[model samples]
Target: MSTLGWWRLIYAAFAGFLLFHGFSASENAPNYSFMHNATSAPFLSYYDYIVVGGGTAGCPLAATLSHLANVLLLERGGSPYGDPNITKLVNFGASLSDLSPWSPSQRFISTDGVINSRARVLGGGSCLNAGFYTRASPEYIRQAGWDGRLVNQSYEWVEKLVAFEPHLGHWQSAVRNGLLEVGVVPFNGFTFDHINGTKVGGTIFDEQGNRHTAADLLEYANPRGLTVLLYATVQKILFRFRGRRSRPEAYGVIFRDGSGIEHRAYLKYGFKNEIIISAGALGSPQLLMLSGVGPVAHLKAHNIPVVLDQPLVGQGMCDNPMNAVFVPSPIPVEVSLIEVVGITHFGSYIEAASGETFSASVTTTSRNYGMFSPKIGQLSTVPPKQRTPEAIARAVEYLDNLDQAALQGGFILEKIMGPISTGHLELQTRNPDDNPSVTFNYFQHPLDLQRCVQGIQTIGKIVESESFSKFRYDYMSWPGLVNMTEHSPINLLPRHYNSSIPLETFCRDTVMTIWHYHGGCQVSRVVDPDYKVLGVEALRVIDGSTFNYSPGTNPQATVMMLGRYMGVKILRERLGN
Candidate 1:
């Protein structure tokens, strides 16, 4: 209350602001930011490590390795800015192939024309993916020929550094609890094991509700040693025979960027010792063979010089195959961990990594019985066509009618959970400068069909459960707008229809890819137990492509751990025996 007190307080506030500015400025004499192209990007003929494919695996690998070595990370895409479609993590994650700009670009086209575009930009696939850390099932890991050791369970160590925290607001919190009241469970499988279950809750987000990507971790790295070259496409691998009649030695990397300008990422930039390729499954093999290190016949087809007669540069690929089943509900209007607790408990994940809206979810799923989904061919058979538009209209109207009846009977449709699943990743080319040709081959396996059938049946049973006896299903798409395209209530089940509403006899429709594309470069099929390319020297892959079998779940988290593990291996390799 004294005049002297007011004067003292004002002086203290002024002093505090000045002190803050002084400390911030002193940390860096002239702060150089990569976001601003700080100094025209340092390029040279030599660098300690030339990491090709500044992708999900490559970026983190480069950042971590740069802690002790000078590293050059080369990416094929342009800068991370100006692309509102890609930079906005939320929309970017949910963005379907149709809406994605990269989908139709020449960079993503395959010679065989089945569209599959997983990011070709600076941040790599993370830029286009939802941020779930889904790992493999035990069955998946064993099939991939990996010891359980490959799955990292040290969340404290990893999260402490990266802080994989969730960004749950009040609305999201309500959804989480409500999902538990329903039967949906968390997925705690062989991986995504949150050290103490903190990771099990829901969509993983940064403190600001933004998705945290591998690129976001660069701040944790010692920036002085890392050089990220965006818009640079690797053209070839510089290598030679180490001894008379011996395998070739990998020396460095050569790349041609967007402008057709050529540059070399030498191993001498930091300490000039080794190289690593984190270019994912497709890109990695393409680069390897382009530099003369793949199947001889394939290389010749691509008109590339055969450096090594390696037969398996791009074979034995695997990825998680999935089909998202939608259920309509208004009460539970957002994503929920309790709804997916079974998978969460198993580290099977649900991620906000996509940072999209509630309706735009990128979650992985599987049955509790440890079974895969049905093969594509064995799914629903073609039914006779509905006789007329009126008949078709009636059929869809009945689905609406049944939905209402179910609501009156106190239940919801639950989820689609079709019982079948299978994923195969196959390569289509050997061009190092281009993205690899790969396929999901989902629903191609027999058991996949059975799984889908079981899922649908389970959903029917849940909707009919006594737990939902109070609310009206209005089957008119209870949770979400399920009636978006009705025509359900097929008489295949044993449920009684109070109203003798006739089901539409004909309904065969095509569905677009839910964008859960995964598994192209298989683990054992592509490399040996140590993840070596079966025959290449000084090269290894540590990305999603390294997966051995598809768990039909989200594969991003597993891919990240693989990258982290590879970085450790590559770093150890550089240290020498």
Candidate 2:
């Protein structure tokens, strides 16, 4: 079926169901009143706590906080529950490639010429990403100074709602054995805990292939105390100035609703009433900077008024670098995402995606639209001051290349789990609707490049193993268009392994982001151990942005755990339990 046909069918199915049966009033059923368009509703006078960006952390945090106090949760995008494009596991790539302004996954290009997207939906990355889920390593919890017992409990709270063990198919099974052949030792079997070995961990997609995201955690929310506003774009955090030298205190938030109507949600009279910024790595920092809490120099450049002048808000951005080897199978493989992952000894991770490749029709349409034309201008939302035409061109070209490459079948992803290189995010324009200027600075350090090279080498070994040899005829030098001899003995290692320069060049050309961005609002720098932003009162940031370092795994689970941990901490502090 065509995309439009599929959408119409989905809409009809949902509408018919809703018409026949009214929404359920059970605790697990989402409250219809809570999920409303902000433009139509009366302005809320006050909320004991306001959580911005109803995403991975925001959803869970707001739900937890609502138990004790009146809470308002604001999300920029519409609900993810009924969106077939988001709830279906097969439409994962389509979710990210969606270019509509209201798309849950907002596509953007980094300053370093990488095309990527961040979740604008209620469930955040969990709604758009490759659905792989794993718990943070014990070392990660220790490193972050989290109470070991509390962290374990937090993981359980999140897992019980959104996570499930995946049933590995033929291709996934082959991947498992291949990893073992590559010496990624003792299989830990199916489990969620992050251990040093090959293992099949939990996935957000359930047995029926329906994706459960962080938004599902809101099922536990206290309906009487929780109010969720969709399409509520938070423009800035409102603060009350005391004196020239006195610290600024957060009082409320200034936001625009779906119809471009502005609304204010303020903190109630209690001293403990607070505002939490749960936007992801890029978003949290951008919101902070927009609220005048970033480096004074950057704010001045954008002509934004400074409030706190804290220099660390948007700094320390880091993302895992990923490279892939596409193997086009003549025989069809079962559709799957990351079911079995290889935690290699070389500080890298190996995962694979199997199913139909992205169609060639997409590339044809893109080319016809003159993507390469010199007249193709930069995105209008990108301000003239921050626009880099060359970078934009390079990013567009890379996307074109990637689309063309994806037309062929089988997919394997090799990622540098712990990269030494880092990047930063800054505002492009003062407009909250505009995307931030992101610089992942991928492979900037020599060690990062070497790690990627090692990862690719490991993947080559896995593919060459006897377990994967059955699909040998399916091998292609690259995706879509074949560059080398058909099915000739695959060897990326012999040529590139011994030579560093060629390997580096290959990595530079093919390396892309796995979308595991973290550490923009880093602990000890932007927020304290308690997750509160420095030099600010009644404000905290509790998302992936607050990660001290990358958790060295798929971060969706960790991000959810952080929300649970923060929620419990806030409750404990408030109730004096």
Query: Which of the numbered candidates is closest to the native, going by highest lDDT?
Result: 2
CA-lDDT, candidates in order: 0.45, 0.75
Tens-digit lDDT track of model 1 for 67-138 = 777767777654433333333333332332222222311224222222335566655666555454544456
Candidate 2 C-alpha lDDT tens digits along 27-92: 233545466666554665699999998998998888888899999999887677656667766555
Taking all chains together, the TM-score of candidate 1 against the true structure is 0.66
What lDDT score goes with residue 119 in model 2? 89
- Model 1 spans > 4 angstroms off: 1-44, 79-115, 134-157, 161-202, 269-272, 330-332, 335-341, 344-435, 461-472, 476-521, 550-553
- What clash pairs does model 2 have? 408-480
